[model samples]
Target: MLSDKSRPIIQATLPAVGAHIEEIAKCFYGLLFAAHPELMDGLFNRSHQADATQQQALAGSVAAFATALVNSPDRLPENLLSRIAHKHTSLGIQPEQYQIVHDHLMSAIAEVLGDAVTPDVAAAWDEVYWLMAYTLTHVERGLYGARGVSPQTVWRQWEVEKKIQETDDVVTFVVKRIEDHLVKPSLPGQYISVQVPLPDGTRQSRQYSLSRADQGDSRQFSVKRVHGAAGKPDGEASTLLHTNVSVGDVLTLSVPFGPLVLDDYSGRSMVFISAGIGITPMAGMLSHLATTGSALPIMLLHADHNENAFALRDQIRDDIVALRHASIYVWYEQGADSKLPVQGVFAGKMDLSHVRLPDNAVYHMCGPVPFMHSIRSALIALGIPPRDIQYEMFGPDLWQADYE
Candidate 1:
């Protein structure tokens, strides 16, 4: 909770801070990287920095946290905190790093605000920063404890046993520990961070969802080649993995860490919706259901440009066929192949109007922000509770603040 003395000060200056938050974030990163250059090598996503998404996310989070503190001091924003904590834990963010961030961030605040930053105003915002930092540090500690690993010890080396082309753009890597060791088990729908060395000698990291059920000693994850559009540069990590990484290559991987896991589906129906490469986690859950011989009613829906663009389509079909009570639905914007014998596939955008949605079913969706937004709104209109609909995002979560 914010101290009562700081509450009124924050309320008075929030508008000015919010209006200039982006500038502060930009300045913070500049100062931080100048002092700690190693952070860019492996800890931070270079792509996000280049596009300013990381800065925007940071700015928005600080402003939102401050707003919530002033408006409802009695309540904590779990949604915001949970999202951040999960991402931080996945990256192995240590508690001490928060102080480094604080130093640079506070300096940036002072630099941007100039004479407006009185000691009282500075102290109030300082209190706000520590409150958020301490809360996140506590949450991250719990996450590390649950995973039974210390923050700095979460990384392991894995050798790529095989690289299978799932589609023209997507490739799946079957990996196992370099030495004969037991791989840590992961829940269905969890993800692992893969760090690869770039040509420039800096290591870049990206997270990919585990695309299959845990296999005790090996795991599978897919990477889609990211082709830059609209004058942007191609994703460095994806490009390097797609073109240079091959079977027998070693890569650094983090322990599986993600919050979207299917822990229970005993008596309730389930709806799984995904688009493009977002189908990875959904495939993991479906594989688990099949391996466990679950008899719960399940509906699998996916949207893609066409059949040729669908990753792991055959595997998903086989898993669905193995389940006792499961059905599959697909939507294609560019039309499915005419030679394919699949029936009841929709054409053009995804439309749920003609479909009968299962009653009292839990919904899990992963895809582009716009796609999830549209599906979520439609589901809500059809009487599904907001709490019942969960989603997984692949990159920096710029939409979560507004969506919530």
Candidate 2:
């Protein structure tokens, strides 16, 4: 257990450490990759690794560790551990990588902080680091215990059968088989990683929220093209998945994983808020609700550029039409002809004021950063706990920014 004296030091040091986090992340990745190159073959989705999310997440974890030491000074929460373990489990991060990350992280902090790196500061950080590593180490081991190995164990071949365009930028991928049967039971809201062997031999991988409702059907990923940053194109993998990768192209797919999943609505009510392609996971949830005929009160709130581009609006309404308890609030950013299957309708941004969400509503939301942040801030201000909120990234994990 951490003593009272340790709290103030860690709290004070966190902001200082956070300022140089970018540099620390650069050094940490450099050391990690140089010492353990084989990790890329198994543990990294090349495209997502290139994206800053992974680096930011690692750095944020360190900062959060510092916060946890000062504030909680107790056991790591189950939800936090579950999310961390899921990240590593999906990436196939092994037990050894934790030590490598720690050594390099500590080295980078020392190298950057220079004078401020006192004995107490170093010791405090050490305490935080070990606690985090301890949590991840044990959590990963437990996850690996029951996770029966996936068919496409390596980042090699995942055959893409069809690429259907949902929007100008987003496309749905139909992957026939990874190494075995295509139709296996996947939890609703769970996502799979897609690895594409690029033209230059380096592979790029990305996570796509599975758009399909039925887990019993063939796997399909509805991925949006993120026109890559710093001269990088919309990810080699996502570009391939959208443009060239079609009918009979093999790509690598990791097993489905994510903590943002549906509950045994055998008895509870919930609300889902989505913007644009974020509607996919909610579609899956609604489908399950329809199939199971669950009496849970489902309220869906979606904000899109327009109704025409509203991905699953009508399909969702029709799915559970019998359940009058299910209602949709559609907000079209563009003043388009808003008509049909929508209640509490508006033509501007999501109306946060006077918004009466269902009693005991669990808000599952996803969208661009600004949109989700606005909604989250509003909800929290209105007395929503963080646990009652769930969201998924259309691209890489945004849990880092969420933490920050």
Candidate 3:
């Protein structure tokens, strides 16, 4: 129960907080790390901590919820709620984690707002936070229930027994050993966390989607180098992977898990839309779909900066031709002279608005945050059912707004 004086501050600041959630979240993280250095071993990835942009998505999403809660007098946009929940869901965020965040976040907000704060504002925000938390908690519980698993039920590390490059930027790593598991069962679309030592000697983990949809002994994951951020072009983990990490290099591995999967997508026209490195999972899905003989209007919508950066473009084209009901829409951001089945392959940005998103399609999408937001909004406007749509963002799953 918050005091009456704090109510307005909670309300007035939330929208702005939502708008600039990233900044607030940054502050929260700073305080958390500064005050509780011990939490880092289990919580913060040292490599990711160095890359500020890497954690911005997570913080921004948390702040977004804070902003929305202040306006809880009116129901939050269902899309916002769902999108946020999904984002948290992807990172294996738990309900207890929310309470911890709320406590620290409220403290941070009070500190930020200073003398202007009051009891009512705090109470209002508290109620709102708990309410929003309730929404996500229930949904997440249902998701866990459906899976019949507990939080962190699947998280582990592995050693890189062998590695090979599928392309200049994309590499395939074969995990030969992990904690207690020389072999483990992992579903396709699930990913393993590859921990790499950065230049600073600190370590980080990046999730790479498995190239196959099977629970087998020899598990493989394909990772695409992520460039084009404000800081550096090539990310540290990927750069190290391409330039340094080699066979016999052991990397911490997590039990493969992700909301995005090839299952539960049966008998549907699987529309796979990917931009740049986002195509990694799509390649796996396409490859698996081809083998399973259930390719239904599998439109592999791929957009790249230019012809040179089109990862696995030729493979998708070739597979599309071989498999019935499969095709590729190639969009080179710079320009493409090729007379491909380009359903509007211009040398500009690929926005989701131009495409007549097929109806009754089970959508599997991945891209930058802004790109995913654009496509998600377009899909909703086009009357696509939320369940029919699936997406995975680069940084965090803040798809609380994108409810399925």
Candidate 4:
């Protein structure tokens, strides 16, 4: 909770701070990287940094956290905090790093706002920063403890056992522990960070969702080659994984971490919704449920460019059939499978009205932001509570503030 003295100050200056949060974030990253270039080596995603999505995410989160502190002094934003904590834990973010961020961030705010930043105003925002930082640190500590590993010990080497090309742009890698150690099991919908050493002698890390149920000594994850648009750089880590990595190559991996697990949906109908490469986590969840012999009702609603573009189609279809009460639905925008079994295929964009939604169904979605936003709105119109719908983002979570 914000102190009474700081609350009023934050409430009064929020509009001003929010207006220039982006500038402040840009300045903060500049200062941070200039002083600590080591952070860029493996901790931060160079692609996100170059594209400025990371800056936008930082600006949005700070403004949202400050706004929440003023509006709901008694309650913290669990969704925002949990998402950040999981990502941080996967990247092995330590507690001391928060202070370094605070110093640079405060300096950036001072530099950006100039004379408008009075001492009282600075102190108030400082309080807000620490409140968020400490809370995140506490949550991240719990995550590390629960995983039974500290930040330094979270990474392990795994040898790629198999590489299967799923589509023109997607590839799946199955990896096993090199030292024959017992690996921590990954929950459905969780992701692990893979750190790859590039040819230029620097390492970059990216997170990929586990695409199948955990085998005792191995894990499976799918990566989509990110083809950069005009004037953008292609994904370095993903490109390396696709072109250079082979069946015998070793890669560094983090323990599984993500907040979108299905622990609370035990007795309810589960709806897995995805498009593009977002099907990875949904496939993982389906695999787990099928392996456990779960009898819960399940509905899989997916969208893709065409049948040929749909990754894991055969695997997920088999898993759905393995479950006693489950159904699969697909929407292909480009083409349809004429020879396919006739029940649940549709043409064009996804329309929820075309299918029947089950009672007490919890919706899990992952895809482009626009797609999720459309599906979320449709679900809300159908009387589903916003709380009942969860989404996993592929990159920096820039839309969290909008959802709040």
Candidate 5:
């Protein structure tokens, strides 16, 4: 809880700070990277920095946290904090790094606000920062403890046992721990961070959802080569993995860390919706359900550019077939071939009007923000409560600020 004295100050100055939060975030990253250049190597996403998405996410989160503190002092944003904590733990973010961020962030605030940042204002905002930081540190520590590893010790080396082409642009790597020990098991829908050494001798890291159920000693993750369009540069980590990584190669990977697991499916119906590369996690869950012989009614809905563009198509089909009670519906913008093997696939965008939505079903969705937004809106309109819908995103969560 915020002290009574600082609450009024934050409430009074929130408008000014909110208006300039983006500039402050930009300045903060600049100062931080300038002082700690090594952070770019494996900690931060270079593409997000280039496009300013990371800065916007940082600014929006701070503004949201401050607003919540002022308006709903008794409650915290558990969803937002959980998402952040999971991502941080996946990237091996340590507690001490929060202080570095705090110092630079405060400096940036002062520099951007100029004379308006009186000592009282500084102290008030400082309180807000520490409050947020402490909460995050607490959450991250619990995540690390659950995994039985410290932040710095969460990484391991895995050898690429095999690589399978899923689509023209997507490839799946089967990796095994190099030490021949039992790997820490992961739940369905969890993800692992893959760190690769780039050509310039700097290691870049990216997270990919575990594409299969936990099989004890090995894991599978798919990577879609991110080709630059409209003048942007190719993705550094993805391009490196696609062009250079091969079977028998060694790669650094973080322990599995994600909160989107399917913990219970006893009697409730389940709906899995995904688009593009977002199907990876859904596929993981499906594999688990099928392998475990779950009898729950499952509906798998997916969208893609075309039949040829669907990653893990055969795997998904096999998993669906393995289940006791399951159905699949697909939408393709380019239209699947008339002779295609799958049944009940549609052409054009998804239209749930004709589909039968199961009662008391839990919905899990992942995709581009726009796709998820449209599906979520439709689901809500169809009487599913917002709390029943869970989603995961590949990049910084810009959607939270927009939707909230």
Candidate 6:
């Protein structure tokens, strides 16, 4: 909760701060990176940095946090904090880093706002930063505690056992633990961060959802080769993994950490909506359900460019077949595969009109933000409560308000 004194200050200054938040974010990253170049080695995503998405995400988070604090002083944004904490824990973010970020962020605010940053105003914003920072650290500590590992020890080595080509642009890596310690069980829909050394001798990490259910000491994840379009740089970690990595190669992976786990909905129906590579986590959930012999009705509705672009189609099909009350519906923009053993195959973008949605079914979706927005609007119009729908994004959560 924000102090009464600071709440009014934040309310008055939020508009000005929000207006220049992007510039402040840009300045903060510049200052922080110039002072602590080591953070760029593995902690921060250089690609996101170069593209300015990281700055946008940071700016949006701070503005949103501040706005939420003013609007509802009694309650914090647990969903926002939980999402950030999970991502931080997966990246092995330590508590001390928050202090570093605070210092640079404050300096950025001061530099950007100049004379507008009175001491009282500065102190009020400080409260906001620490409040958000502490809340995140508290949540991250619990995440690390639950995993029984500290930030430094959250990563482990896993050797690639096989690399199966899922599509021309996608490949699935099956890896087994190299150490003697027992592998921690991964819940369905959880993701692990894979850190790889780029050709430049710098390491970068990227999160990939567990594409298969827990297999004792082994795990599976898929990566799509990112071909940069429209002047953007290609994905460094993904490109390296696809081209350089092979069987028997060792990779560093963080323990599974994600807030979008599929809960044990014993008697209820589960609806999975996905497009492109978003199917990875859904595949994990389906695999888990199949392995556990779940009786819950499952409906998988997926969208893709074409049959050739659909990764894990066979695996998803097999998992759906294993479940007693599961069915799949696929939509292809170009054409439909009539021979595919699915409940309904349609041509063009995914339309819920052709399929029957189960009564009181919980919806979980992942895809591009626009696609999710379209699906969500459709679902809401069809009388599904927004509270019952959950979604996951591939990169920085720029569409936080939209999802909420």
**Which residue runs of candidate 5 sit more than 4 Å off their true CA positions?**
180-182, 336-343, 401-403
Candidate lDDT values, in order: 0.87, 0.71, 0.65, 0.90, 0.89, 0.91
Top TM-score hit = 6
lDDT value, residue 358 of candidate 3 = 68
- Candidate 6: where is the Cα deviation over 4 Å? 402-404
Residues 252-311 of candidate 6 have per-residue lDDT tens digits of 999999988898665679999999999999999999999999989899999999988999
Q: Give the TM-score (vs. native) of candidate 4.
A: 0.97
Cα error, candidate 1, residue 404 (Å): 2.9
Give the per-residue lDDT digits (tens) of candidate 2, residues 1-404. 45566566678888898898877887777777888776675457655566677777666666666666666666344565567777666666766667777888888888888989888888877777777778777877665554555323423345666777777777777776555533346687877766666677665556667666543335777877667677776665666667777678676777777778898553667888899888888877777777777788888888989877777555576875856578778888888366667667787888766357877778888888789888998888889887788777654444543454
Ranked by lDDT from best down, the candidates are 6, 4, 5, 1, 2, 3
In the range 1-404, model 5's lDDT, one tens digit per residue, is 78899999999999999999999999999999999999999999989999999999899889889999999877677787788899999999999999999999999999999999999999999999999999999999999998988987889899899899999899999998787433578889999999989888888889999999866678899999998989999898998898899999999999998978886545889999999999999999999998889989999888999988889889888998888789888889996553334446888888887588999999999999999999999999999998788899898888882236
How much does candidate 3 score in TM-score?
0.75
Candidate 1 shows a clash count of 0
Local distance difference test, candidate 2 = 0.71
Give candidate 2 misplaced runs (Cα > 4 Å).
Answer: 1-15, 34-53, 75-81, 115-124, 150-162, 178-184, 215-217, 228-232, 320-324, 353-355, 394-404
What is the per-residue lDDT of model 1 for residues 282-333, given as tens digits with 9 covering 90 to 100?
Answer: 9999989998999999888889999888898888888988888888888899
lDDT of 4 by residue, 1-404 (tens): 89989999999999999999999999999999999999988899878888899999999888888888888766667888899999999999999999999999999999999998999999999999999999999999999998988998889899999999999999999999887544679999999999989888888989999999988788999999998899677888999999999999999999999999985346989999999899999999999999999999888899999988999887887898788988888899987563333258889999999899999889899999999989998998899998889999999898883345
Question: Quick one: ranking by TM-score, best first?
Answer: 6, 4, 5, 1, 2, 3
How high is the lDDT of residue 326 in model 3? Answer: 71
